[model samples]
Target chain A: MLRLPPFQYHRPSQVEEAVELLDRYPGDAMPVAGGTDLIPNMKHRLFTPGHLVALKGISHLHGIRVQGEELTIGACASLTSVAQSREVRTHFPALAEAAGQVAGPQLRNAGTLGGNLCLDTRCTYYNQTEFWRRALGYCLKKDGTVCHVTRVGRKCVAAHSADTPPVLMTLGAQVELVGPSGSRVLPVREFFVADGVWNSRREPDEIVTRVRVPLQPKAFHGSEASGEVSTRVRTGYAKLRQRGAIDFPLLTVAVAVALAPDGTVTWVRGVVTGLGARPRELTGWEEIAVGEPLTPEVVEALAERAGQQCRPLENMIQDPGWRGAMVPVYVRRALGKAVKQGGGGSL
Target chain B: MAPTHRIVRLTVNGDTRTAGVPVHYTLLETLRYAMGLTGSKQGCDKGDCGACTVLLNGEPRLSCITPVWEAEGLDVVTVEGLAGPDGALHPLQDEFDLHGAAQCGFCTPGILCSAAGLLARNPRPTREEIREALSGNLCRCTGYTKIYEAVEAAAARLGSGDAERERGERKEGVS
Candidate 1:
């Protein structure tokens, strides 16, 4: 019986008009693309915007377009479309898999790609109803000062619960932001912040318009235009959760690797999310993986190194210790699967 | 003063109608309260529960979280609309009844809409596809074994015909 607080709603037929409305309302309004996540959060009293600018009405803000070597996906494109898109599945299966894995069918149909990327950081303490949060004395994420995760820390440590950002981070995607001043494109990695309070760096008056990802090579062999190449860029994703469906990941791993024709890992990027305020690209993998072929030993060693760098606090479902301990295992399996593209995951 | 409300028009069960709804009223509230399409249940007001599922332009979407204003110019189909003009049961509904797929029947409406969405796109879905399609719709009863069987049986009966194809009779002809 939780109902949304009353708010003035505006529907703009164009992205420009939407940006103008956002600029007009600034601090008093919030843009809603699909309302999949925001509506629930609003019901929980997480955000109480006096005005809501609906983004789904904009016709231009809804499709997948290929411009040269890049693929631009509108912010309002539904996750179901993104998941089922043959173009996305063909060039970037990880994005499709991540989109498909979000919640379930009904949600996927309503949730949008931009909303998923800009999903609010979720925490057991912060996501509760206002009455529940009130009883707990409120946390830094909302009305209070102290953080429940790290009692001494002043910042919110709510986990970044979005699935697409981690995979998009690994894919090196860029997000396009439109505001009253103008529009600018930034790397997806730069779009997120380490603090949960202002999880995404998107300014209050700015709305994310689309995400542009340079199309990746179909294989590790060479140019995408050079068709019929047998080699392919190996990619894989692994998410550990409590259920087979409808549960957010305790830990998510996405890995992409391009092999040297000889089978040595040439270029590799790995990211692990759902652990902290932001999805982090694991460093030090190149130190061990660059020249060496991905044997079991190399993959295992790299996974251990990557796991050491991840700073997972006590957050999300289940015990934090168990969740933190799973980082390396999932990473190892993800990389192993990436090494064997056509083959099933190792483990 | 009374809150400002919009005169919203929506196409429900192939009929276009208008209603004065507050901007904040979700499609669920409008459907259950104003239009009286109570078949779409209100399990979880959030998108977590699929009880408020309905077809927005033939795609299953969470009506609870969807604003009533967004349904303007969109085709909406509810479980009540699943029956034929002569009131014949949808194959999926008949199968659900045959296999006792519904226990308490709280989650059946949403599950049915989600299954209809799946059968529309993919005629003969595998067991895994059926499970994936129903992932958003949660059922506390039946452990999903009976529901899966029911969807499978419905798909068998609906082979190659339009998933939206209603049985019995249709003057305008069914999809």
Candidate 2:
């Protein structure tokens, strides 16, 4: 029986009009497309905007197009469409995999990539019903001033729960954002901020219009022979959750790596989500595995190093210590699966 | 403040109907209360339970959290609409009966719609894909082995040309 608080709903026919509506309402309004995330949050009284600018009426924000070497996915494109898209599956399999693994099939059918990318940071303390929150004296994510995750901190410490950002970051994606100042494209990695109070760097008036990703070689090699020339960079996603479906990830790890002709790792990029305030890319890990031949010992060592660097707090569904322990396990598993899939020529 | 009402037009179960619904009313409420299409159950209104699943523009979506206004101009197909114009059961519904997929019957409508959407897109999905597609829809009564079998049977029946052809072959006893 959860219900959205009363509000004025406006359907804008264009992105410019949507931006103008947001600009007009300022802090009392929010834009909604899929409403997969926002509606539920609103019912729980997490956010009570007086006005909601519906974005589904914008025709230009509903299609996927490829221009030259890059693919532009409209912000209003549903997660199901994005995951099942031939172009997305063919060109950006990691993104597709990430999308496919979000909440579940039902949510994916209605939720949009824009909604997922712009997903509000989540915390167990912040996601409860208003009654539960009031009973708990309200955390800093909503009404209070002190962070429950870091008791002394003045800001909220909600974890970034989006599953798509890590994979997008691994692929070097860019997002088009429109605001009163006009449109600008920034690296997807730069869109998120580590601070929980303000999880995104985009202005309140800004609307993410499109996500453009440059095409890259397919990571899965279709050959069975263990030849070096046929070896391609491998990408994989591994999520840790209490249940196999429907629940958000307790911790997620995405790994993309390039191997040299002799099987030595050339480059490695590791991204972790559902752990901290935002998804973080581990840059120094390349040096740890670049020269090594990805043996059991080497993978374990690199995984341990990555796990040691993650500072998981008691903000998500699982225990902080258990989630921290799982970092290495998931990291190793994702990298191992990617390496195996790359070498074995299977998706 | 008291809730304000808005008039919404919805095409549900092959008929067009209009109702003055509160802004907070979801598509689930509109279907169950306004149009009397109560086949779509409300298990977990939070979208965790897929009992409120229905087709919005031919794609399966959670109707519980979906606002009624979002369905203003869309074709909405509910579990009640799965029957033919003559009111015959859908092949999936028939297969559910044949395979004993319905236990409590509370979760059947949602699972049926989810499977229908899957078979519409992929006529022959692998077992893993089937599991993944129906992961959102939960069934607490049957162990889900029977439900999966019913979907596979429905897919085979639907993908093999015509229903009459399958029925005639079944009558011919070709196993």
Most TM-score-accurate candidate? 1
Local error of candidate 2 at residue A36 (angstroms): 0.9
Query: Which tens-of-lDDT digit does each residue in A1-347 have in candidate 1?
Result: 77998888889998889888888876889999889888999999999998899998888888997888788899999998999898888877878888889888888888899999878998888988999999999999999998888899977889998888887777778999998889898888888898998888898888888998866544222232223244355677888888777777788999887665667666678899998899988988878877677888988898898789887787665888888789999998787667666522222
* Index of the highest-lDDT prediction: 1
The deviation in Å at residue B143 for candidate 2 is 2.2
Pairs that collide, model 1 = A219-A232, A219-A233, A220-A232, A220-A233
What would the per-residue lDDT of candidate 2 be over residues A1-347, giving only the tens digit for each residue? 77678788888898989999999988988988889889889989988998888888898988887878688899999888898899887755667778888888899988888888889889988988999999888988788776777889876779998888898877677888999889998888888988776698788788888998766434222222123444455677888888788888888888877676677776677899998788988756866777678888878887988888898988975789999999999998888767765453322
Residue pairs with clashing backbones, model 2 = none
In terms of docking quality, model 2 is medium
lDDT tens readout by residue for model 2, B113-169: 998888888999888878988899989999899999988888888888554334444
| C-alpha lDDT of all candidate models, in order | 0.84, 0.82
- The residue ranges of model 1 lying beyond 4 angstroms of the native Cα positions read A216-232, A342-347, B1-3, B160-175
